[model samples]
Each structure stands twice: as structure tokens, then as C-alpha cells.
Target: MIPVKISEEAIKEVRNIMENKNIPDGYGLRVGVRGGGGCSAAGMNYILGFDKPKNTDKTFEVDGIPVYIDKGHVMYVIGMEVRFHNGNDAKGFVFVNPEIEKELN
Candidate 1:
């Protein structure tokens, strides 16, 4: 099984969004790889509040929240950690995958 990590803040944010939007069950963040905007390589994409994930998607639970990742992205995403940063300069969820950088460089 692929391992995924999610920060506490991100969990809180997702729960808050779910509560505020009154979204029913089955809504979660989806991450996947797509053709990189006409580039020859693929890139990552993230979608929040998605109902149905693609058939080729794999599901992982992080901090009691469900996150979906496309099968094509699994190899690249394994061992990756999702973190939420909230500072005066920046505030958001960030993906940290060192293997990807090493591969790119």
C-alpha cells in the first residue's frame, strides 16, 4: 500500500470546509497526475470537494480524511507528505516529495 501523510491543519481545514459547505458524505480532496499543460511530461493536480473519483484512482486515509490519487501518480507519490502551512507570508497545503525532486534534477 502507498503511504500518504496529511498535516493536522489540513485536516482541520477540510473538516471546516465540509461543515461550512454542508457537503454530504463522499467529498474529499483528490490528487492525481495529468498531462502537464501541453508539456511532454505529466504534472500533479489537486481538487477539493470532489464527489466521485476516477476508476483508476486509489484511495488513502489521512488524519481520518480520505484522499484520492490516480494510479499513474502512485509511484511518484508514495512516501509523500501533505503539510499545511499557515504563516504571515503563506497559508496552504504543500506537497513534499523529495524523490520527485531528485528524479527531476
Candidate 2:
């Protein structure tokens, strides 16, 4: 199973983007953490992009989408869920971590 789970809505949008953007073969979605992430209260911010798997990466095929996670970032995003929001306030994928939500409470 993937360390991070993606919601169904996010999956559909990602597939559309991959087709429209013409993402190259052998390249897949990369999920990772960026330090001091803005728009989030978590210790690290999550990032999504298309990239070729690196030697240090672990790959997962989720619903026909290839996902890559660098080893060092695995722990940070474990159990996290990625959702797509297309409301008036936001129009993007939002990362939600249950652990972080608990801490915030």
C-alpha cells in the first residue's frame, strides 16, 4: 500500500492533468515534504509533481497512477490523505494528516 493515500476526486484530477499536460512515460507523481511549508500547520509541507523515480525512491501504483516517495520523506506523510478542492476558496489538492489534525485540536 502507498504510505500516503489519495482521495478519489484527487485521482481523477491528476489523471486529467497527466493527459492534458502530456506527462512523459516512466515519470510518475512524486509526493514529498518541503521544509517550512506555507498554507499548512504541519512540520513539513507536502509537494506533488511528476518526476522519474530516483534510486532513493519507493514506488506505488495507486488506481493506475504511479506514485513515488523519497525514502527520507516516507515517515512525514504516512497515513496522510490527499484531496482535491475546487470550491471558490481553493482549487487544488489539499493534504490532510489525521495526526496533525489531532495535534491542532
Candidate 3:
């Protein structure tokens, strides 16, 4: 099973994007880690985008949305929750990972 989860709000937003953003057919949500330490509270940054799977990827479905995660990145990203935040100040998907926090502690 995928060790991560996507919030209802995030899933809704993804659906909205899929309909209005014209994401290419066969593309799926890609979740992985970025190497830049400064980009997130955790040393590794989070990656979320739409792309096709490659040989090195592990694929799954979350709420009917296809998801792809590079096999190498799975360890660093486990137990994460993907959420959408919309407020007066900002709006976008926000990643919350207690697993990383436990490690950092």
C-alpha cells in the first residue's frame, strides 16, 4: 500500500486542475522528494506534479487519481499527508509528514 495519503481538499483541487488545466492523457500525479533542504522543514523537499511513470517508479491510485512515486524516494516520503490550503494569504497543496518529524526529532 502507498504509505501516503491525500486529503479530500487536495483531491478536489487535483480534480479541478485535471479538468481545467488540460493535463495530458496518461499523465498521473507524481510524488517524490526534492534534494533541496531549504525548500521544506524536512531536509528533503516534496515533489507533486503530473507525469507518466518510468521504469524506476512505483505506481498506485489514491481516490481514483493515479499516483507515481520513484522507488528510491519512497523511504523519505512515507507516512505523508498531502493537503490543500486556501486562505486569505495563500493557496496550494501542503505536505504534512509525521514520519519525517519523528526522524528529525
TM-score of each: 0.68, 0.86, 0.86
The residue ranges of model 3 lying beyond 4 angstroms of the native Cα positions read: 36-41, 99-105
Q: What is the C-alpha RMSD of each candidate to the true structure, in Å?
A: 3.9, 3.5, 3.8
Report the C-alpha lDDT of model 1 over 1-105, residue by residue, as the tens digit: 545666677788877777888766876677655455654334655333446567888887776667787787676556766777889999877777767878999
**lDDT score for residue 8 of model 3:** 94
Q: Give a tens-digit lDDT track for model 3, residues 30-88.
A: 99898965545467889899999899999999888999999988887788899999999
- Would you list the C-alpha lDDT of every candidate in the order shown? 0.68, 0.89, 0.88
Name the better of 1 and 3 by TM-score. 3
Residue 104 shift from truth in candidate 2, angstroms: 7.2
Winning model by lDDT: 2
Compared with the true structure, the alpha-carbon lDDT of candidate 2 equals 0.89
Using TM-score, give the best candidate's number: 2
